[model samples]
Target: MNPDIISVVIDKLRKLSPEKASDLTVKNAQFITLQSLDLDSLDTLQLAMDIEDALGMNIEIVNFPATLTIGQLSEHLAEMRAELREPA
Candidate 1:
């Protein structure tokens, strides 16, 4: 699950902002933020849509704070997934 979250996030980040191969790695993503990625509001919306499509979870932009990091986003998504798996 951890790997999946990180991989999806990394893939989306790369696709959204096509940097060099050396850029946007899991190690760097720990501190990378949406703002730093030059992801505007539209880019963010696209990211959310892509994530929902890929993971089947409704992770909305409004659900996050202004300053959001990729690592934090991955962690939040993991929590959401865990909640879905819990017996309600």
Candidate 2:
């Protein structure tokens, strides 16, 4: 995953869950689940929405796996961004 993209995601995560953000780091976040960050379904949904708004893209949540990690999610979003820039 792009480090820049990961940083942006981490910043958004911090805004959404400041309590858990302090403990999160790019290296450790690769293996941690959203649930481990104390984010419930609603929080996750809100996070997704916030990410979309921040990045200005329509990310299909259905494409996300059930057991998603922060690294994987960041990689996926980066891929989606690349796809969007491709000539149609």
Candidate 3:
């Protein structure tokens, strides 16, 4: 996973969920689930949209796994970004 992408994700989380973001660290984000952050469904959806916007790609909401950690989500987004850059 790209560290830059991870940093962007962390920044977005901090902006969108300051309460939960305060308790998070870069290392811990790799193991913590979004559910553990106490984010409601709407918050989670908004976060996804924010991430998608930050990454300049459309993330398929249906394919998102709720159990994915921040690192995993960043890795997944990196993959999606790669796929988009590939020629059809």
TM-score of 2: 0.84
- Per-candidate TM vs. native? 0.88, 0.84, 0.86
Report the lDDT of model 3 for residue 63: 43
Off by over 4 Å in 3: none
Selected candidate, larger lDDT, 1 vs 3: 1
**C-alpha RMSD between model 1 and the true structure:** 1.8
Q: Rate the local accuracy (lDDT) of all candidates.
A: 0.80, 0.78, 0.78
- Candidate with the greatest lDDT versus the true structure: 1
Candidate 2: where are CA atoms >4 Å away? 63-66
Candidate 3 Cα deviation (angstroms), residue 59: 1.1
TM-score of 3: 0.86
Worst 10 residues of 2 by lDDT: 59-68
**Residue-wise lDDT of candidate 3 within 2-82, one digit each (tens)?**
887888888878886787777666788788777677777777788889888888888766545678888888888888888
- Of 1 and 2, the candidate ranking higher by lDDT: 1
* Ranking, TM-score, top scorer first: 1, 3, 2
